[model samples]
Target: MIVSRTALLETLSAVQDTVSQLIGDLNESEIKDIEDYLGRICRHLRCSRNALVSINKLPSEILGYIFQFIHADFASPSRSWIEVSYVCRHWRRVALSMPSLWSVVDLRQKGFDVHKLEAFVQRSKAAPLTVFYQNPPSDHLVLRALQDVVARNMYRVRHMHVKADVCPPFSDVILSEPAPSLCSLSLWHKGPAFPLLHANSARALFDGRAPLLRKMTISACALWYVYRITSLTHLALYNSEAHWFGDSFVDMLDGCQQLEMLFIVSPHLRLATEVEQQHSNRIVTLPRLHLFYIVRVVCKCYPLPWLRHLLAHLEIPEYCDFRVEFWMTDREVVPEGSILSIFPPPAQFHPLEQVATVKLLTTSTSKSCIAVHSKTLFIVAHGDAFPLGLPNDFLCPIARIVIVNNTETTSFLLWRTLLSTTTHLKTLDVFEKYLDTVEFIQLLCPDLGAEGVSPVRCPGLQTVNWACLSYPDVDLLFGLMAMANDRAHCGSPMRAISIWPSVNGEDKRTVEFDSLGAPMGYFTRESTDEDCPCLHVVEGLIAAATPKRPDEDGW
Candidate 1:
């Protein structure tokens, strides 16, 4: 007989009361049996209730797909999207049936479980794998076992990344097999500068069979030989012995004609270990090569031809976005020559020559690095060593410069040097927190030149926008008025002057002409304590609610 839900519950309640009355009279074993029976009933009741829930009615395929979205290799063992499986048996069954959800096995953690790895492999079935391995199990036997598993599943492995501090024993042995399905690979060795492999036959990587490999990275490691992979498009080498490889490196480039982006970054040079070997003068022309980036290269002794010699071998496309990061090799002496060495040869187009705009934002780090790119150049430096006179002739194309959120004075020479080089600069915007607007005005409007032949600084400048820590006091206003009049007299008349957010009017209030009426725009920003009595109180409450970085002002 079909019973109503309420009637069924009433019947169950009566049975529970009858069982309670018998519990006191029953023996210990009998009571245990009754408890087990009640537990089973409770499990059935939970399943019944869950069946009535709306979401549980979703098809198993949809539920499994949703599980895949939530599943991630965040941590191991417990914190998995698979946790949803524990909520119900149906979910567990559905999750087990979906193979792709368990494909990526993160064997990077120190506390990784081999049993869990085995389970994932079994559950993944025939799905393509993207294995991430770093700082894996230290035991030699365990490493071999893990390597065995990877080798067994090599046919389906699509991507693999392995980074180990002390080069693992299986690092090279695992690459001996033909990776038919491999598409991308990254191998990083953080150990001492030792040879990456030991082989008598000089076998190349992947047995020269990674047909589908499109991207590869070799950091602080070396291969026996440069194998030709026609499909490689992106290649990045960090701290590798590319200079020592010499002709072999060029041969590798020649093999991959379809290569597009190449990155050679942060090579800590070691001359004692390597011998100077002469390379062929033949320049390899990469027809499809577009972006070539070299970053953070240092040679304590300037005029090292190692890098320049290497670059001379490659003829990249003229319009390619080539970028180089140059660090000051010798701080005591002026590094003009050292800096010049890193810049693209005077024969070719300097990347910085075409930049129309430049932006400088102060960082929290003391150490500085300079990045010169095709469309823009980012020179991150300390206030003192900030590359003054950097915007020389090559930066003449810059029409606008924006300096924002400076916590300290960058350099006096920086302002003067910029003014002298900016031949076509029309817009200058400075959002500063360290210097007063009056100070900026003084720095900007310097003497005309020797014998007054040269024009005023920024001869073609027309518009100026400035924001500072302190509000526009009377002195700042007077300084601006004087600056405007001086520029007008010098034939570089001001077009428009703008000041945004006096203090903090984040929401753009009415932007219009100021009282003086010489403006493209002006906006009344916020005022601190003076403007609002509860401002400090509200700020304190907000500050107390969240975490702050060490470099923050309040922190």
Candidate 2:
């Protein structure tokens, strides 16, 4: 039945009286137990009634905030705030008139009606819009509905996300008119070829001035069409061969003075042909560029000398590489110095100490060891490049280390060194084959009189995420937890230790965890998934083991 606010409040008052009368006959302890149970019901009813009444009397601005909160929280398209509009006449008008609530339209559900989508767009009024299209490849109706919305209020769209197997063809109807309000555009095509759009059309779309176009991402496109995008602050081009047209790509960046973050993935970095190299003396300069990432490209050498030249002009502090092409030229190799020379000196314009995270994917041979520092380092080693002696100053300010290798000996050596040094290390994540050795467990908790170092040295370590896929040992697992408990009283308290049986899968069985005190929690084959349960155990153990003051006690 459709109930008014007055009627709902009257019903809640009656329910409250009944609960009070029932508790009147109970003793002190019984009444105290029932207090929590009855209080929840009263609070729920009161909130619902208050929301209904406030929908009629609250200021329009205040009502708009509540509606926006509800819209953002209800991400599912099937579960909308329209139910509030159905509550009563006044609520229906308030909800329908609040254009902000309808600004974000998510059309991800399968078999979503195009007409309903059109209705939603209309209800959004003239407010800036965000549209997410996540439908199947064959769902042409969804595309048609999106086209309809764009055609009507293309100027009002501020952000757009399209996730489909194949992007709908970009025609004059979709691109001829400029979307002046469009600031961010993310298009994901999970299919093979790029969407059908003329090169001229693509160029025209970006050639126009978009002062607020700060971020853009385009993945897996066919042709190389780069335009002058003047206002772009961040740009990402993935799985596209734009490097063949390097001149146009450089021209695009030359236009954007405020560009900061740039990512180019698996790009076909075409070298300058003999004719172009001889004729062109133009040097492209990106003065404002800071963070640049290059990944999985097939170029034999660093393709963009322009990028290196630009970095020489700026003050960058962090750098990363994934399958980058490092040229082995005679002049590039340093004789007796160190592998650290491979990295460019911190901007002479700025101080080297400002540098923070330096990550690389390389073989851990004696040569690569020179790059290791006391700062934050994330290394993914490959092949026989394991078990090398690391520097004593290794992990000086290192906070996190993730080692992904299959060598047991190398893993043991690295783990021992980390347990011995790295005084400030907070998280140690060891993956796959590294945890298979039986001796590593002994190293975790050395004998009292043994000359070897013990886990007690890593007093500041709070979390350990160890995944041992093969040869899982229950005894060694408990022993490690016992060691953590013994040392928790000293240093920063050890809150959680998560042990994953293997990298391929998790053991979720109900394992006994009573042996380890305050800071320890265990989960086996029956408990939960690997990473999630480990995170939960960490939080729970930290809360349980942390010391509290008298005034910090709960009510």
Model 1, position 200, has a per-residue lDDT of: 33
Q: Give the clash count for each candidate.
A: 0, 13
TM-score of each: 0.65, 0.48
Q: lDDT score, residue 44, model 2?
A: 78
The local distance difference test score of each candidate is 0.63, 0.54
Which segments of model 2 are wrong by more than 4 Å? Answer: 1-61, 73-78, 165-172, 193-197, 201-203, 222-226, 242-245, 265-281, 295-555
Clashes of 2: 13
lDDT of 1 by residue, 1-555 (tens): 899989989988998899878866889998889789989989998998888888789999788878877766333454566567678888788878988778887776555567877887999999988787776345555566578877798888888887765354476566777888988888787676544545433565678778898998878865524344456899988787545446666777877788999888787675523536654777777878888887776654434355656566777665676655556555554444333344435334334456677666554454455444555555554443445444222443778877664655544445555556667888888777664424445665544222433334677777778765544443344455456657667666776655544446341212122223233322122423344443332233233323346775544
lDDT of 2 by residue, 1-555 (tens): 899989978987997797777865878887777678778877777766766774457886676667676776224655557677776555677789987767777787554578768777878888888877776767777777677777777787888777765434533445445778888877666776453344464565633645576888877763234345567788887767543334545555666677777776665444535213322334445556665665553333322443333333433333321112222223233223222222333433132333233332334332222132233344443323322233332324455555455554434444454446556656666565654454445555534313655444566666666666653454554466566656654435554566666576575222222322343233333323454444454344344434556786632
Residue pairs that clash (backbone atoms under 3 angstroms), model 1 = none
- The number of clashing residue pairs in model 1 is 0
